[model samples]
Target: MSVLKGKKILLGISGGIAAYKTASLVRLFIKSGAEVKVVMTPASKDFITPLTLSTLSKNPVFSDFYQEEDENPIWNNHVDLALWADLFIIAPATANTLSKMANGNCDNLLLAVYLSAKCPVYFAPAMDLDMYKHPTTIANFHKLQLFGNQMIPAEKGELASGLSGEGRMAEPETILDFLEKDWQDKLPLKGKKILITAGPTYEAIDPVRFIGNHSSGKMGYAIANKAFEWGAQVILISGPTHLQVNYPEIEVHRVTTASEMLESCKDNFESVDIIIAAAAVADYKPKVVSEQKIKKSDLEIDIVLEKTTDILAYMGAHKKKQFLVGFALETENEFQNALQKIEKKNLDLIVLNSLNDTGSGFGTSTNKVTLITKSFEKEERPLQSKEAVAEDILNKIIQNYEV
Candidate 1:
């Protein structure tokens, strides 16, 4: 998946023949999973219509400072548009617009938004060969870069003036590739591999009956999503969850039993830098799973049970350089139980969840957790959405991550 996934990108269009290309650019950004809004210079409308852009972007196109509604002027807030963007890109940045940007000339709404923007700004220059190589235009490029704006260097190609040289704007595909590479390079966990286990495993007692917990896999899927967003290559081992992840970057392995989950973890454990075992694996399974359904004939039918494979302990015993983490859902002595699991399971960190805490535990969207290290140091978090809890857990892991 593109690193631009979930990013809010504002595309600025200026008057140039290349303004026609912004339509393709917007489509490409949307395809890469980015939210796009377009702001066009008044003169740019001659090259591309606002209706065309609006239809493609599925957002109202903005050109004038204000539009008449009921014959009343409703201001288009430039600051809000600037602040809403995670990134701003000006493609077909004509000489006129580039000069205005370099010299603080806010004549149009696009220029006003650019000047007000707090996010990273990128400009793709488009002009005739001679105009692009002019001393003033080159100076503007240097000035913009000095102001921390990135330049998606204009490609060498045929220009509208019939001259073949470095003046044409980069192609839509090239711009997308450039953005993804630039963003990925700066991510903290760009090259790291993370293995996370989520949901509750099911142990079969009969063909039609099984034992399972109330785990909805929300917490684990949240972590997996966040990890991928932070640039980690994620492998998620889920145990019979109905939840699905939005990011395709996360590799999912589905399992039904604790034994199956363990084998899946074992397959990827050696190659990963970190492992978070959040699954509530059943401690016991029926020793003999009946092939046929057992009818309700007896008052109580007794089935022999045996201990399931301890996945966390197995990882603890076999870990080499991996930073292993475990979760402990406790009813009493929460802190002590969590600390004990840290040492007994050879975990570097453990997350403690209590059934007593309202809005926490399984089958809920919110969670309250105490992050405990092997040294017994604890950091307690108040009840919050599972997404926020996931961020906290990943942050703690990142703080202590080495190698």
Candidate 2:
């Protein structure tokens, strides 16, 4: 997989019986299009020598900066090594190494690099059942998590010492898959959660008829997918759309009417970090929806209508700390109408769609949008695929957060 193409991985080998597996892991990473650098501890060399790993990785392995006695080895620079790694992974980590890492003890080249790494760091611990279950080991694991380090839990299987238990280093194949998945899952919005509303909400006129827009929910689904790829946990509440969410990162709640969509959104509002109100909900609903289909109607018929709940405005009043975004589709006074919604609903940003521009509105794969901020500044762009527009909108949200 080119997923790890041009990626640099630092494979740290600590003292463990599982150190013998490093050769296979190194080859796997290389096959997956990654540059592998092996860093072994002195004790680790007893189980598997650096020569075995160096041949597989096609790079010299280094354990320390000090020169050897009688036959001196060249000193390796820790700073250069630490800066070269895109991800530092310590597989077959021993309990002793875990304690040292947790305590910030940088006595070795590997430990020093671990302390200095600014990139993502991961570890796979391996030991006997007793050590893995120890209270101290559990505490150390938590300490690493607090520092934002990722841990690959060891598998339960036959150990080298003839004990079948929960401390075997995860298999080379499993670890390789984990590395690839972690490398590809972008986390720009990590630790942030969001809720979104999409599609056209129907207002029932009779058993067989309703009032709704031509909204395809394409733009909204694109936004949700992009947000999820950026690492946000998304809850999508949609109304009367045939769309199927293609990502596991999003939780979809399908509804039929404006009221149902609003209720679902309200239920998830507090837990969400941001809210995108993109659904085209009817402003008015027939006061009395006939139980039966209206058949053989008169030449001219009038249906009494009542105001539907304004989703965004209702949110503005009940909002605590959630960031809100809205959309305005208008045939005339587009910018003005969008700006008014931005101010009235307390939205951080509003996207304006003009009906006057052909191929730029509902039921189309393309959209030309004007992003109007709460500050009254406008940025307009030409029509593009809904996915590209979603990317632009996500980037704008990132910029807004930075500002």
Candidate 3:
């Protein structure tokens, strides 16, 4: 998936022939799963109608600070618009707008929001060859960069003036690709490979029955998504579950039994830089399997059970240079038990979740976890969404892992 997925993008449109291209830009942002809000200079509306942008973006386009409603003008707060965005971009950045931006001018609503925005700002300059080559324009670009604004360098293409040079706005597709690469390159986890196991392994007893836990695979999926967002190449070994990975970049191996999960992990473990053992693999499985469904001839029947292969312990025994992490869900002696597992499994870290804590354990969306290090250090986190807990877990690893 594009790195822009789920991002809040504030697109700024300025007065230029390239202003019409903002429509395509907005469409591309929406197609990539980003939420877009457009802010257009008053003069920009002359080139592209607000109705067109509004229909494409599914959000009202803002040009003026207020709308005249017969003396009851509705106000649009620039600060709110600024704060709502995760990032802002100005396309078709005319010379007039660039100078005003560099000089702290707030002549229009777009400039006002730009002045108040705290998120990263990017601009794509569009003008004729002479204007682009002007010394003042070049100085403005340097000044904007000095102020921490990124410039999406203009492309060389046909202009409205029937002249072609390095002064055309980047095509919508190019703009999208540029943003994705820029965001991915700056992430801390870029170039790292991660392996994560999730869900509860099911041990089939008969044709229709199996033993499994209440694991929903929510926590592991969250971590995998976060890892991908941090630019890591992720491989997920998941037991049978209804959950789906959000990004297509994740290499997923689906397994139903503990033995299958173990084999899958073994196949990918040597290639990963880090391993997170999140799957609740069944400790025991039925020794004998019936090819057909067993009839209810006996009210109570004895079925022989045997221990499943311990995937984590195997990884520990074969460990070379990989950072291994484990999870322990305990009903008692949570801290002590987690620490012991850390040593036994040779894990670099362990996440401890207790059933005693409310809103945690099993299939719940929220988790209250204590992170235990190899040295027995404890960091407690309050109950929060699984996504937030996943963020914390990865943050701990990223802080200590070299990659």
1-403 per-residue lDDT for model 3 (tens digits): 7789899999999999999999999999999999999999999999999999999999999999998654888889999999999899999899999999999989999999999999999999999999999999999999999999999999998988999888999999999998988888888788889999999999999989998899999999999999998889999999989999988889999999999999999899899999999999999999998899999885888899999999999999898889999999999988888888999999998999999999999899999999988878889999999999999999999876754
Q: Write the per-residue lDDT of candidate 1 for residues 317-364, one digit (tens) a residue.
A: 999999999999999998877877888889999999999999999999
- Local lDDT at 38 for model 2: 88
The whole-model lDDT of each prediction reads 0.92, 0.86, 0.93
**Which candidate has the highest TM-score of all?**
3
lDDT of 2 at 171: 88
- lDDT-superior candidate, 1 or 3: 3
- The regions of model 1 sitting more than 4 angstroms off are 68-70, 103-105, 247-249, 287-292, 302-305, 373-384
What TM-score does model 1 achieve against the real structure? 0.88
User: In candidate 3, which residue pairs get closer than 3 Å at backbone N, Cα or C atoms, i.e. clash?
Assistant: none
Quick one: best lDDT, which candidate? 3
Candidate 3 has an lDDT of 0.93
Sliding window of 10 residues with minimal summed lDDT for model 3:
394-403
Model 1: lDDT to the true structure = 0.92
Q: Per-residue CA lDDT of candidate 2, range 1-403, in tens?
A: 2456557999999999999998889988999888999888889999998888989999989898765673856678877888999888999899999999999998888898888888889999999998999999999999998998899999999987888989999989988888777866665777778888889998888878999988989889989987876777889888888887767648999988888988998899989888888888888999999998988856887899999899999998788878788898998888778878887898888888888887888889999999877788888978899888888777767767531
Answer with 1 or 3, whichever has the higher TM-score.
3
